[model samples]
Target: MSWREEHRSNLELKMGKVVRLLGECEQQLIDETDPPTKSRLKSQISELKGQMRDCQGDLDSFGQEQVTQRNLALTMASVTYEDINFVITALLNQRMISIDGQDNFQPTNPEEKMYKNDLTHNIKFFLDMGLAKAGEVRHFVENNAKINFPDVPERLKASLNTEYIKLIRSGMRGDELFMHLYKFSSHNNPDPLRQAAGLAVLCYFFETCDVFEP
Candidate 1:
């Protein structure tokens, strides 16, 4: 399932549970006429209401902050090193990049190499998965971006460019800027392939747009 869908499902599940508990509390509070018992039930009901509010707040944040990708969280879990390596090889074959003996992208400049070298595996990891799904992941990413960015490719490029400019102005070096972009894209996710997917998408944009310079 897509990450967005899964996240929504979890939030909905929590909301449902909170609502059910709230109903049970209200019913018990109404049935208990004893002053002390009623007071306890009221306290319990209040807590449940607070929990319900918290759940609602989380749902709202999910709606607002998690704007865009419906990433294939489950699909990413099964990727292997060999699969990523093959994708890297394919990229090299396509003349998208040149590889060294260690199979890392050999960019022309030291700065470019420093920026992309550390995340070589991660970039390849998502590339393999994206193409394997017949570009399903890639298509959804663009589709999702279209919600706020009507210009499709150009809007996407502008968004990344803004971030790149901000990072540069903030005194971040090439390597640091690259890492910032990766983490920003991944939402600092702990999942390996998911994080890799973030880098892969960034790499895609870099190729198709002018986000970074050599």
Candidate 2:
């Protein structure tokens, strides 16, 4: 399940517990004779109610945030090689990729290293040139951009097309393409979030193609 789903489920479970506790507190208040004991039970019931309200509020807020993100994701254009390359360039410019002596792209940090390893494994196993390369490119982008890697690829693909998949299969790869796209896209666009969202959309596309195993 996605993190959002898990979070909502947890909130629901907590709310259920709070309700049960509140019921017990009310029952205790009815059975108690001592003034102090009755006061304590009332306080406990009040606290449980407050906790329930807080949990409900958090659940509602999370739902609203999900809707907003979905709308933002939908506003993006279909993913293209240009978009993928743009994200890759942004990562490279940020110094997230390390150039090995053999000219291979390696990770420059612990987080990047993890993503790199994951991509390398997927490429080795999946053996789909378009998907593998695209996945690797997205791994770099998502790691550097600091966005939570999307759980549903289809959600990400809401704004992507399949044109870039064929291009990657036909031997389009590496930092050169990334740099070219970056220069073109960043020429007039100053917003980094826009670039980040593009990368995320590309990630969704690759994932839908079964390239991004993670």
Candidate 3:
């Protein structure tokens, strides 16, 4: 097993022990009539539950770290959409993002709060790579949406638009909305490259086609 998987296994085992201990403490408190002893047991149970929560959080972070590693691997590609995503998110985060559309000139009309501060880490995470070759992945995506990778724009919009709007209307924060969008597009696919592509598609749509107004 990978070290992360093994570490998660160990955490699971530790969590199991904490749960059993918590159960025992609760049972002891139920049976013990002594007030001070019951208070001590209550405190112990609370601590055990906190340990369980921390362990679960560690386990969750480990899973996300695996995705981070996978995306890091994708950065080695000659042309990377992550760079495109970085540019768009960084511009939005800075309140200076603008996009000229066919006629209306979208100007990336996002709610100020949706972009400022919300995408700092989102931009930082991709910038952390600093390995993405300077390329016009965004321009490529825009130009070829109907020619080279014809399916991408249509398919991405068809797959994501309605839910993207729903998520925005639901008042979900930007980063959280992106996570849900990523999972929706990725669909738990196990392939790393596909995951990267899925993320690129989502980020691209975020810039051009989706509703970020709420």
Candidate 4:
């Protein structure tokens, strides 16, 4: 009838066609019979939902700040292969270092033994990575400032450095080379102080352990 009314009717017809097209698409997807394809589609839908939830959480926390977004990206980049390798070396092989006073530092119980072993493995990993050396271990025992551990915190570094000096001065000799590992392995020692002492010793061992043989 009227020009405006005709235009509105034409728009409604276009909207109806679009709705029909969407419904047809839904029906076609529903008719798919491949089990693997269906499983994949379901997995994709689940992932999208999880991602939507994460996006919603992020928006609530920081709300569209481009700088925050960039900071997160940078932080992710910082936690790469080298960082992971170093941390794993620290945690699993405590022998990568050498703490001082190994003679006075015996763990009195079985739990201490376990802790010592784990720390020893961590030390081995560090040595394998070339983060430490045997001569450095001996030097640290005589005077800690000689040995360098980049990832160790400053507060802990002083204590660890002291341990290295103590281990060598106390008598880490010959077959007793494994004394550091035995003292620090997670399975051997449970006392936090003892375990930590063991870790320092292991770092020295890793630094100095005979890499050529093993």
Candidate 5:
């Protein structure tokens, strides 16, 4: 959707029109000598105000839907460990940040917080390796998988390569990066291949698939 064509604009237009209509109706009511004429104008003004409220509700719902769509789209992307690490570091390095909303980056203690901070610095090293390079993310993701789960299936590795390629192009934020990580960590069945995709990410991040924190 074009930015100008969004629901907010429609609401503003509706509000402005309603305000003008209400002002005219109120003025007419004040001028009318007949009680019945005044009652009709008062009813017209109330109807216009009700329509404005409905328009405002629609705008609020549309804004919420946009946020939901963006979240779901990013989740479906299911970023690799490399992408997650890259984004977290970007925030620590004072690059990208949340222009709105809260970032829950608290660590349990000073040491854990320091460790999280260090992870952010390490990401800068990865960033210096040319984050925009086509094969860079793929190489880092595949290498992470190889180091953590040497027995990862070939088909899963290939799918990861494709997803990393897409992730590099989209430019997700730090929190968004981790949110997708959670989405990527879900497995559907006993098929080791499908399960391995999720396991590789958990193992890479938390040192083991079973020990990983949500």
Candidate 6:
């Protein structure tokens, strides 16, 4: 099996053990009446809960990575409208677009046309031109993944749309815009898997496509 698969399997095993232990600890808490012993058990339970959460998070990340890798590989091998649709669907499901009362990273369209049209154009551009160089996709993914949008300066946020338009007009193409959107989405959602998936879709686009210029 691949390292990724093996890692996931190991995590699953570890999670199983932790879950079993947590159950035991809960039982102990119920059975024990001594104050000092109960306190110790409670502490252990809390620690176990934290561990479980960590394990779950790791598992989730692994799953997202797998999906992203698969889709990227497919896109690189075969550039097609269907693959593009897949990427779009993944982004939407991951909340890269807005929902009621929940802000996302979707750019404000100055034209005010259908949002999907803008997304489609951007995604197609990245697939066609953004990944022209070796390792470009990897670099883009690494850099953008590190961004936490909430920590950005308020001044920047206030003029994000204007700045984005300027950048687009000034030769900023597919990969760059995608990264911007991905970071914004991640900041709003605060879910690692969802963010990873969005990035993966963009990476897939970057990996595919024959056209290398805007």
Residue 194 lDDT (model 5): 31
Q: What TM-score does structure 6 among the candidates reach?
A: 0.30
User: Per-prediction count of colliding residue pairs?
Assistant: 0, 2, 0, 58, 0, 0
Model 1: residues >4 Å from true position, as ranges? Answer: 1-138, 141-150
| lDDT score, candidate 3, position 182 | 66
Q: Write the per-residue lDDT of candidate 4 for residues 1-214, one digit (tens) a residue.
A: 8975454334333332332233233333466698887776556545544543443354344344423332322232122223323333454443335543333232233224324433343233222212212222233344433455543433233343444445556866332444443343323544433333333344433433211111
Residue 106 error for model 5, in Å? Answer: 60
Pairs with backbone N, CA or C atoms under 3 Å apart (clashes), candidate 1:
none
Q: List the residue pairs that clash in candidate 5.
A: none
Model 1 per-residue lDDT at 138: 42
lDDT (C-alpha) at residue 103 in model 3: 29
Per-residue lDDT, model 5, residue 193, is 28
Error of 1 at 130 (Å): 9.2
**Per-residue lDDT tens digits of candidate 6, residues 92-148?**
343121112222233333223213224443343222222221133333333444674
Highest-TM-score candidate = 3
Better of 1 and 6 by lDDT: 1
Total backbone clashes of model 1? Answer: 0
Candidate 5 stretches greater than 4 Å from native: 1-4, 62-214
Per-model RMSD to reference: 19.7, 20.0, 20.1, 24.6, 22.2, 17.7
Instruction: Write the residue-wise lDDT of candidate 2 on 1-214 in tens digits.
Output: 9997777656645654554455456545656899999988888867876786576567667777534332322223123345555644443343122212222222243224325324443221111212223433455445545654443232222212222333345665543333233233333245543443343434334344322212
Candidate 1's C-alpha lDDT? 0.49
Question: Where does model 6 exceed 4 Å of error?
Answer: 64-214
- What's the CA RMSD of model 1 in angstroms? 19.7
How do the candidates rank by lDDT, highest first?
3, 1, 6, 2, 5, 4
Write down the lDDT of every candidate, Cα atoms only.
0.49, 0.42, 0.49, 0.36, 0.39, 0.43
Instruction: Write down the TM-score of every candidate.
Output: 0.35, 0.30, 0.40, 0.21, 0.27, 0.30
